[model samples]
Target chain A: MNPVRTTLVWAVLVVAIAVPIAAAAVSPLLAWRSPAYIAAGFAGIIAMALLLVQPLLIGGYLPGLPAPRGRRIHRVIGAVLVIAVAIHVAGLWITSPPDVIDALLFASPTPFSDWGVIAMWAVTGAAVLAAFRRRFRMRVRTWRHAHTSLAAIVVVCSVVHALLIEGTMETLSKVALCTLVVLAAIKVGVDLRVWAVRR
Target chain B: MSVDLFTRRTLLVAGGAIAATWGGGLHVPAQAQGLAPTPSMRGGSNNYIPNAPIVERIGGGGFWMTGTVRRAGDGAPLAGQRIQIWAHTTEGYESDPHSHGATLTDENGEFRLEMPQIVPAFGQPHGHLAYDSDGFETVFLRPVMPSSKDTSLRADFVLRPV
Candidate 1:
């Protein structure tokens, strides 16, 4: 890609991710919320934004940043994503244990909890599988297939989870980000075709 | 004539009893259902708990707190405003930390939150709301519900800038 086009692509991606976080910071809700809740809320926004990046990075969809460099950033983002989930749950736990317990136990009346928990487990499972691939005696092709399946689950469930929520996020920006994430996820799935790892 | 008068008085007493028994079914004025002359209370939220759990909904989600938050003078809808609500309910008292939760307004400056049916306490069924965001001068409200059977209550706030 030409330098101008490359810069445009990167800039659009950054702004798409940053807009939601920026909206939350100026939210009057921030004044009423506890520190833990605010931290958790922002962490969730960051994690969702990072979701859009992960697929693009791994699939080499980014213009300037190619696979090798993108992959390194992807690894660091994975760690951050995990920490974000931990903080999200922890903040919720502090505020109300029974509610979080119901969500974890799959008994919460809310549908959003189920989606979030499913996405969360899928992400965690993929991370663990990656960490212990050698011990599990998994070949490269097998690991790739397994990881790809989990990635697909994470993207779909996370999108539903975010869309179902009626919280502090501005609706227009939230929908835009979600739509972009879904399109990006689909692009990677079709382009990379990680399922056909049998070379 | 005396027998006819006695019969008329007996019927009147019976009709009065039935009306009293089913008062809620009567055509009570809709305008009479809310707190009369609701004003910002003096030290109303002295019982407000810090960090009282910001949540999307509270308890079993049967009752709702919904209203518009707007600027005081301009009456412009204030999107993204925060309103913290609590009441004595099946779960706990208004002062109980568990009973408290906060929610943010949407793009149109409207806010709604689900909570358990508020039970009457100290002879009044009421819900406490506070415009406790820093950008506005604090305004607290204690709105009286006309009946405990009410599933929803509305409390519109016009907050003055701090």
Candidate 2:
């Protein structure tokens, strides 16, 4: 990908990731700290990882000139994202093992926790599905369609998870993340519109 | 009329007795207490051990002190806290080992303190603390300093990775 596209991707990722973090940073001012903050932090981390995965799905959809290069970069970023997500989850585990376990196992008492867990499962499923797309004999267009739909679901669910949560990034981060979600939607919309016009 | 009256009286008394028994069973005593079957205070997991020990903040800027931490007042390792050690370098874009590093201080302060794990050239390190190739390397937290002193504990740390 060119610098512009790379920059845009990073921009979106930063906004998606940083907004929640910013919210977390101001958590003390809000005077709210509970299982909610831990939930929010984990959601942010997972969303950040998903942002890194976005370019991979993009590369998968858009073919031609240096496709292999994009795929390579995607793998590298995916690896890094895994480490980051692990760190995020690990921090939570150390902080509150019971709640973390609850979230992971779909037993968390809070409703928003379910959203996060669902997003995690969806993202994991998408990754696995993409890995075995060929084995399932999924046509390129069909697979791309499924991938795009799943990606949207992941992003949307993650955003909802973050919004419902109050943590270090209580307000501004949610607003910022919500804005990025809107921008990402616009980008996807434009891409679809262009594709439709061409069709 | 007499038989009917006697039968009604007996039925009423039986019903009243049942109702009284039910109420007695449902009622809580005047000395009702909170919690139940009090488990041993020393046992089970209701104890909050203060996981604050897991977050270790080290190697950063702003009158920061670099040191090592161990358990108790001994040279034992303290682990499981979020240990973030950070410091800064004078040169911009230059690497500093003390910039920002994190580790879970083990039960003993035998933490294998790695320098700030930055993306090097890719991502911008957020905090102002710097960790470059030069300057104070490897932090081994000795228990000599108390928590009241430099929070980092200023324990002796060697340059080698253990």
Candidate 3:
């Protein structure tokens, strides 16, 4: 990609991630939330935004970084994404353990909790495999298929989770970010053919 | 008979205002100040708790939950119907026990409760109201504020009695 196009892509990605974070920070609802709850909420928001960048990093959608460097950053980001999810869950746990427990057990009445819990598990599975693939002597092709499927689950379920939620991000902005995340995930999935591992 | 007829036919135009807010996001406009019926939206009541104690106010100051309780069809002010109000307020989260309270309508069918300002939860500044008093169909009204700065949220209910 030319320098101009690369800059434009990077700029768009930045906006895709940044605007929602900014919008949530100023949400009126934050006024009454506990610090732990607020932290947890933002952690979830960051995790969702980071989802937009992960595939782009691995698939070389963002131009300036070299392939090897981008992969390294992708690994680092994967770790951060996991941590953000942890904080998000922990914060909610502190604020309301019963609710979190219900969510994990899949007995919560709200539909969003079910989706969020599923996404969280998908993220956990992908991270665990990525972390131990070398020790397990996992085939690169096998790992690719598992990781891709889990990533798809994370993106799709998390979008549903966030959309089902009514807080933090503005409606239009949340919709915009979610739409972009799905589009980027699709672009990379189709372009890179990560979904299949016939080779 | 005519009074009952009016009450039955009376559509809480409040839904139109709610629709406007729904179309634009929960930014309650000038019209949501009137009482409203949930119509078919009890989904947002996922956080509802059973039998919250009636109290004088939810929080300290600024925000107000005010509306009228009218009989469906005739729009008669139904005094004595217990109206439960709760929200994520400066004092507590909507789910917190302390944040919930119930109030009764005056003879005029008007209800009012003062509390700390409502903050956004899940990103929208909103309040929850319900008519849990028996003898009438239960209603849960989740009304959003026009802006974070708005101190008052009104959701009048024209309840249909069973």
lDDT of each: 0.77, 0.46, 0.81
Clashing pairs in 1: none
Per-model TM-score versus the true fold = 0.59, 0.42, 0.66
TM-score of 2: 0.42
**Chain A TM-score for predicted structure 2:** 0.65
Interface RMSDs of the predictions, in order, are: 15.4, 15.8, 4.8
- Give the number of the best model, judged by lDDT: 3
Model 3 regions lying over 4 Å from their true place: A196-199, B1-54, B60-86, B94-162
Across residues B62-143, which tens digit of lDDT does each residue of candidate 2 receive? 3333344432222233344344443212222222333444554356554444332221110111122111122223231212
RMSD (Cα, Å) for all candidates, in order, is 17.2, 17.9, 10.5
- Model 2, A1-199: lDDT tens digits are 6777867756766666666665566554223223533553555555554564454354443333244666666555554544555565666665446557767876654456777667666766667666787798987666766766666666777767766653445566566656655555557546654235333
Question: What are the per-residue Cα lDDT tens digits for candidate 3 across A29-98?
Answer: 6776799999999999899889988888887878887667888998999999999999999998887665
DockQ of 3: 0.21
Residues A14-73 of candidate 1 have per-residue lDDT tens digits of 899989888878865455446776777777788889889999998887996699998888
> For model 1, how does the per-residue alpha-carbon lDDT over B1-162 read when each residue is reduced to its tens digit?
245754767888988888786785663444234323335853346357755557979977899988888776556678988888987676765657778999889887899999988764322467878877789887787776777679898888877777
lDDT of 1 at A107: 70
